[model samples]
Target: MLVEPERTAYDLRFRLLGFPIRIHPLFWLGAALLGAFTLNMGFQYLLIWMAVVLVSLLVHELGHAVMFRWFGTNAAIVLYVFGGLAIPQAFVAGRWRRILISLAGPLAGFLLCAGVYVSNRQFHWASNPEGFLTGGREVGFFYLALLWVNLYWGILNLLPVFPLDGGQVSRELCGLVWGPRGTRIALQISLAVAVALVAYSLLCVLTANGPALAVVPWWLPRGTIFTAILFGLLAYTSYQLLQQLRWTDSSWDDRVPWER
Candidate 1:
């Protein structure tokens, strides 16, 4: 039925750096569906966004897979709507190794963003005084798209939220400090953060306010329904993770985050 297509789509595979890469069709479907919102930006920009997100996400996941391989095991990648996952055959031997692997993904994203930003600077978009007000010139639309998505998304991905790189990193850190109770501590921290984010998003949307701090960037996402939905999704995941606390150690590795 409906689930079959999704399964089949994600099952479509290829190889990257010798690791299997399975791309879920929803990735494309989600990007294509964004066309409605980008109608004013034109179909060309929509196409560019889709392509940029795909490539940037691939790079991010490759960072994880590459690091995983360093631990002497093969890994597989799954790219879907939100982003990608690099699942390894086994966890690395040490907590520091696991932390390094977790950090590698965001590091890759940062590097890719910097690379794109530098490559696009020659186009002279920044020289246009009116660039910021106009979303930059057409010549730099894709560049801006790539830069913003990679940079902002990469930074956001590093936030200490469960299943996120930063969250996983924090989890390992807590494990080092707290012993067997680290998992529960991590879950609690993630839930608190998720609740705060959800509350912030709701407050921004409902009260038309943002962080009171003067230094907070005005360009940071706020009061958007889309971001609200994202925070809502994160809240759901936080709830799920909280419920997963009872899981035994052996069951943890066998299931993916989405499954939990």
Candidate 2:
């Protein structure tokens, strides 16, 4: 799930801020499927959702790429089915530096969210005359979609699950504290968290509660069926990685210095 995808004939290639970007065919499909609910309103709304997703994901990946460059490594961005990947052409050595690079993606999203909020307040674009949040306003829906993806998706990506930014940080921190046993410990942590999220997502879906829970309050984020499937796959990936680590006779971690 975390591997970089191979290039395809249908891939859309471009450059932004000196960073090469490739958008796989599956990326559009994934974005569309995720925003399929918006189609109920109209086709135009779905297009807006796709545009929001494209801009948001591009920003997120650029965040990582910028950090990679700051660390003296060039990186390429790829938008694939699962999400996006910022693949470093050259490796950066330090654990702390890598952690920062991992964090840059979500932090970038937050910054964009803040910028959008500020712009809305300044122009009063967020105001809805129909007294509904979106109120059939394209501008309102655009702001809503942008904020929702950045804020919620940013938080979700920060969970201590394998292959996520938080998971990378957790692994590094564990390695610092636990020495050779840290990678396994991090994977264990990832598995537990992912499993818990999967269960919560299932509960939400089964009860038809969506992203709210009786105990979680309406304000706090919960999970949906998509989250359940995503976390379930992550949990299984963690389990597989843990098993591999267990079988390795050497004291080294799964990734080599370059791979890291």
lDDT of 1 by residue, 73-169 (tens): 7888888777778888876789998998988888888898887766545555443444462335554667766777778777777877777787888
TM-score of each: 0.81, 0.91
How does model 1 fare in lDDT?
A: 0.74
Residue 245, candidate 2: C-alpha displacement in angstroms: 0.6
Give each prediction's root-mean-square deviation over alpha carbons: 6.4, 4.4
- By TM-score, how accurate is candidate 2? 0.91
Top candidate when judged by TM-score against the true structure: 2
Lowest lDDT 10-mer window, candidate 1?
1-10
> Candidate 1: deviation at residue 229, Å?
2.4
Question: What are the lDDT scores of the predictions, listed in order?
Answer: 0.74, 0.89
Which pairs, if any, clash in model 2? none
What TM-score quantifies how close candidate 1 is to the native fold? Answer: 0.81
Instruction: Give the Å shift of residue 50 in candidate 2.
Output: 0.7
